[model samples]
Target: MKVYGVVAAFWLSLASATILQNGQVRPNDYPSTAISAISSYNSSWHTYSPGSPELSYKGRWDHKYISWWSAPGLKFGFQADQVAISFGKYTSDGVLVAYRLGGQDWMLTNVTANSTHLFVTPSTTGYNLTTPTNVTQTLELRVTNWAYGVQIQCVHISGGAAKLVKIPDYTRTMELIGDSLSAGQYATLEGISSYSWGLLYGLGNVEFSITAYPGICLHEGRCYSNLHGQTAQWLKIPDTSGRALDIYGSDLADIPNWDFAAHPAADITVINIGTNDNNTANNVTATGYYNSYIQLINEIHTRWPQSQIIVISLWSGFSQVGNTWQQGAGFLDEIQNVVKYFNNGSLNGRGECSSCFVYYFNTTGILEHSDIGPLYHPTDVGHVKLASHLMQYIKLTFGWILEQTGPEVQHDTLYWNDEADY
Candidate 1:
């Protein structure tokens, strides 16, 4: 967890114009006459940066209207941590290109749009220019046919050089404990995207480490006789050499003894285990899974006395585990009750009070398939949906502004290398 302070320094450019008010997009700022100019506030011409565009199961083209303005040079002085473009292709070859600042015609850049029906964040390059230059910035859709049009949900801008007071690094350090889903497998065709990993990767700042096994069920009785290998594999501490140990029952004895002194204590801990426990046909008991979950929660809370614990119920498509219950009704209902119970319990000294919160978000197995990659994990689209949901919850509970969910846009080109991990 390295933290650094950043400052946004501005340089004078050659172009000049009356400086606009200090804020993000203001509705009327866009040109109403340009083709079919779509602004954020369709009702009121005030808000500029849109919250989020509605994602599609299939394909739909949407675009936002942008205007050309002059401030003197080719740069509009703003810094963001990450940027995302909510757009879709009309035909086969519709690519969103970065229009060079302060230019009339659209100049093409090498940013490739993702095939998934979601907004994709382009790889961050380095600083836009050695020094800031006053220029007009906007996005352009480059399609094979001039008449063909695509739809853009919105443009997300965040994490740039901090202006005014020096801004510190804000990527939350999170600890995830669960099964294959939490491990971030099978989200995309190539398994390149998982909901967890996508959240970590998509956000401008956030570091994550996963501790999960592939086939282990959350219920204690479901543990097979050969649980030793699976348990050892699940807790194989990254970058650590350890001995193989058998894990019987739901008691994660090995994790408690592991040294966490050097590792940055997790700020957020997510527990997503229960898909396998609900493998019964038609009959399932909420109380049964709840009791085991209570024990697991108690154990996790006992160990990480200060970390926040969040429990997630499995997404739709998973079947109920039992002979009498077939659908997800009984299982999810019970799980929600358990979460509500545990959430209240945190305030009663079970976990970190005032700071801990538990929530259950509905996820879909199909959303994972939308990734361009071959794995079944959540695609970038799926991650965005999850992020939107999580961000709302976190904002309401923690009373913190979701920096990425605001009205603002700044053009940036960050040079990123695929070989390195940030």
Candidate 2:
């Protein structure tokens, strides 16, 4: 496979068109190895561009240092299926992590304040994710953080261009199942920024999937309701019978299926739900939610017995019923204990300490805006801070090798054209 260039203009023009069949994973030439080499930072060229005319933030905005490198002749069409992404710990505030393909949002996932703080120690915490449909596309990792200090490595990608059209390569996959956060709203436009992007960019070597709904909760089918002074949608019944956008119900239509094609040969699964659980009056029982979480882990294990499971908390946003400092902290502690009890197996030496395997990320920062979005969701900066925290932990837990990517290729600056902008 012949690799290509890494110039700013190259990436900008490259990003414009449908980047299909340009990213592929080969097993023969590619060895199943973890990258642990670190690359020195270049202040001038290792960070994301300052701002975008189309996007704005309410909190302080700053980007972290990032580096990457692509393989030769490894052109993936916009239709290559089964793309896997994993990465090292990202240590920065409010960072947006993801593995991007062309412009479409695949393997949509994020590391919130809670996930970041819980696992942000000096270790790497990661997930194996896959996309729902089969599309040939380029695999690119993007980060959104204020400052930077971490290394990322792509471990694996399965199959060729036609792999997606037939049956998506079944390498282990993790479903980012949750509400708007997982669905990736205001977080960043589809291809611009996302938690899934970080997963993809960091773990450029794995195949994963995404099963997120814009306004979904874990209570079967529901939305988040107001908890504390915040207003979160609740899980309710949608009025399909009526026309206007008034009626609401559990709408899992956007949820992906369990077909073999969609399911990868996953060995690591992650579930980050529950914020919306406390949204409505019919709040899901913490114990019951814990029980259901265990069952979900079991079901996934049954499919991929050797897989490692991780249950993450929602990024900080609205407070729940008893969200006072001490009460909230205690509630999370209990949830963490329950997760450990379920997935604590024999020492498997997956690198991370088994005891700390099942993790928890709490929203540490207070939101600056109470009404950023319609239902009072966090603004772009809020998501960035959360991603930064999670990336830090992932790097520490997994000593990932850094990619020797050239200067931070600011696509906007490279492709800026006064004539194009009216």
Number of the predicted model whose lDDT against the real structure is largest? 1
CA lDDT of each candidate?
0.36, 0.34
Could you give candidate 1's per-residue lDDT for residues 203-301 as a string of tens digits? 334444555443345555433321422223223332111111221223445333334553456666777766545555312256667777777666656
TM-score list, all predictions:
0.42, 0.44
Shift in Å, residue 266, candidate 1: 2.2
* Candidate 2 local lDDT, 1-422, one digit each (tens): 00011111221322232221113221222112122221221111111121322112111111321221110001122232234333334322223343334433322233322121111111112212334234334444443221121233222233333232222332433333344454344333322334543343334344444333333345443332211110111111111111102212223343122343323445445556555555434456776556655555555656566555555554334443554421122236435655656546322323235444444444435333332333334344454454455546555554433331442212211234579757
CA shift at 65, candidate 2, in angstroms?
A: 37
Per-candidate clashes come to: 57, 103
Error in Å for residue 128 of model 2:
34
